[model samples]
Target chain A: MSDALYHDAILALAKDRRHAGRLDAPTHSHTSDNPLCGDRVTIDIERASDGTVRRIGHFVRGCVLCQAAAAALAASVEGRGPAAFAAAESALARVLAGQNDPENGVWAAFLPVARHTSRLDCVRLPLVAAKPVFEA
Target chain B: MTQALRSQFPILTPSLAYLDSAATAQMPLAVLDAVRAFETSSRANVKRGVHRLAEAATDAYAAARSDVAAYLGVPPSEIVFTSGCTAALNLVAHSFGALMKPGDAVLLSALEHHSNLVPWQMLAARSGIELRFLDVDAEGRIDLSALETKLDARVKLVSLAHVSNVTGSVLDVASVVATAAKVGARVLLDGAQRAPHGPLDLKTLGVDFYAFGGHKVFAPHGVGVLWARRELLDAMPPFLGGGEMIAQVELAHSTWAAAPAKFEAGTPPIGAAIGLGAACRWLGTLPWAEIAATEARLCQRLLDGLAATPGVRVLGPQSLQARAPVVSFALEGTHPHDICQIMDSAGVALRGGHHCAQPLHKRFDLAGTTRASLALYSDDSDIDAFFAGLSKVRKILL
Candidate 1:
């Protein structure tokens, strides 16, 4: 059962760390923390003139699920505007809320996380950190 | 003996190794039965009503106080029951802290849990009192060598943990008390960790005030013991004010009751308090020397196991010389939450994160650690499951 949570895909995504640093002079940056466990996620974005995310990076000082979610989010949000980001965010939310199928899309690797409700925040922390950029 | 002891706790399943006793212990049937008997039979508000139920409730409450006091080797009147250890510490910070003037210092240590640390911070904020902290050593024990430098006539209190919730290092109480006595300072020990190991003779330990939670002692929650010296209790003001703590009420002012009653405002947690007392009585029946030997053996086994694990660094004392069975270790390149999650899948319960001692974690330059604490009921199977789960934790998380 626990193997499903730490599947190869999620582990590889976290270990990849392709987008796991800061962007120089990013347009919008936000850092959020889960005080319960002291897990922190920072999202830095450089947006285009049309308010689309041109370059994005994340730095996570947290669990594998948090790192994996941030990596997945950063990978998906490239060249995407706020509306697209919101849709992606809603898709992940539905998966976490168990309202949507876990085998659906980019967020499918986190299917096991939906069962562990306590860790839903671990998967969503990156999105929470990035939400401010889209909102602003 | 382990199986016999294990049978007393209904929640201990054959497959489960509940190793989080530092957070809370599994209550025995004796305690549960005692609580059930109280709630179902003698249920009423204590200290005021003259009815039959009230008398029984009051008598039970008093008996509980006596049991707790006997366990601590103190006078019954000196015991003040609070909601929990946090509440008890807060009571001291509010009541005894009221006596302190601006610039007066209270010496705490870096290893204190937020419960012991925050109350002093609040005291400092409310009054202009100064808060001085002793540094933690390389092994996470409080650096008592720094005590002399921190203590002076201006230091009115020296409050610290009797045992580190994260490290399980027992404080050198004699050294601390002797040093504090020279400076005429009062000492308060947060006994939340030590109380579960065995009975404590606080009178002999010479700490002026000691506090512990019932939930950590195999009793119900919402109840705790605050045992202070008689003279200090008399000198301190009431923490909370309301019914039962008053002698005479007037529009302008009200006279306060004495000692324990003065601190206990309104209706207390009568049933939980009774359970706490019953827990003390139950603990008294155990053979502590034999239990200590078992715990030490388990502690050494855990230490040896973690020592052999690659990338595992223990956060506390390496040996069982003066430590309890609580063990915390940091796994390099892995988060504690992931380790705990993987271990939980193997039916091995572990606690991760800062263990409410964030400063200690920060000192060690880590975010958190995975902790496995042992109780009297813990057996060899628990330790076996621990190493087994660690193998999986390494494979899964590391």
Candidate 2:
């Protein structure tokens, strides 16, 4: 994804706060800090009643990448089952690693965000936070 | 002073303008030769063997200790060598934390580097002591008025940096020491940033403990000095327990040696210590007044040039009266990282970040700023190069 596309997708997700509320499912959260830039992000993941990922949300207090990452994760995996959720997580990683194009298929809307791999963790923190809930 | 002193450092031959001396100063040939001579001729561990090599190593280490002591104007007995300033400050926090009780307070300035702040913060958490901050003024100077009011009898220790790493604002050590003295509080000065530029005399400064890294003074890394009062050193327990520090080790009980030895537990950085001693001696040979004058001139030139640039705001005191050669600035619409990137591409090296002083950055309402710090080796041409790079950045951004 191009930088503009990535930024737009992340910003769009951030504008919708309702998606961050699906926390009744088994939840797990974790925070990672980058001391070099004072960037910190806390990701919260919720697995639904069907053992699918209902929502991935993050409350981050850091750089733009962190905010974008949280938004990207929340937007990508809503209502998806565990399998699709894992695929999305891997897809996000691939996008950040400059390996795969996020703008393709179901991830087409997220393609704009694929160019910013430097902040992929910021985009995927919510998935990390929700991983334990899905695994357990 | 700089021209005469520049001749001593052969590394000056390169086209590279090294302005990051606060990170690490370039070593003089004297120090390099000393290390080579020691490693090439004879090398042995001190205070362990009875052989001739051991004797020579021990003598060299001991001589280095005395040299550091004399350089800092402290007694040789009070100087304890550690890996660097971080270790020295840690030793103070760890060793002295044993003396504090619950509810006691440790006061620190707002501009302390993480090395000086985190150790005390950990101690505060573990010992249930209150950690307080001495406020800073608008220009990044320590708020002396607030410091006077906040320093009370309940405060056990008052630790602060002699010069701020980010703003390069020099604290009035005499006033700070006197204030702490009034409260009967122990004071530790983090001299890592000040040792290269300022005049240091422990007797005049009257701080109980002072720590500085060798790397900031044209010496090797992995060597530093922790200068404490004789009484304080004698009273504090050893930070680490190991071979050289122990007089006798029993299965149940062990007796440790004196101040310097007790603090240095394992095999010390022998060659590094010797190189530091030689660096100090070499620095002594330079005309300090000339170096200081030249640096002050360069600092003014840099500050004036930066201020002239549109949208640029220089941090810290506008006047160079009590500040060092370090200058931090931010452009209105440009991020510090972007500024640094542009400057780096133009071959003008500079630092861009909070400089490990997050609280201070927050105080100034900034994420980070681009910093250009200078040393004795910096000249007019360096300042010109920096300004030229800034001009390029301005043209691109505008």
Q: What i-RMS does every model get? A: 1.1, 5.9
Clashes of each: 0, 7
Off by over 4 Å in 1: A101-104
Residues B24-100 of candidate 2 have per-residue lDDT tens digits of 88888889898888777758898889999999988999998888887888788999999999999999999988788
lDDT of model 1 at position B12:
99
Candidate 2, clashing residue pairs? A5-A112, A6-A112, A6-A113, A69-A122, A69-A123, A103-A108, A103-A111
Question: fnat, candidate 1?
Answer: 0.63
| Reproduced native contacts, each prediction | 0.63, 0.10
Model 2 lDDT, residue B352, Cα: 72
Q: Candidate 1 has what TM-score? A: 0.97
Best-fitting candidate, scored by lDDT: 1
Residue B340, model 2: Cα distance from true site in angstroms = 2.4
Each model's TM-score?
Answer: 0.97, 0.81
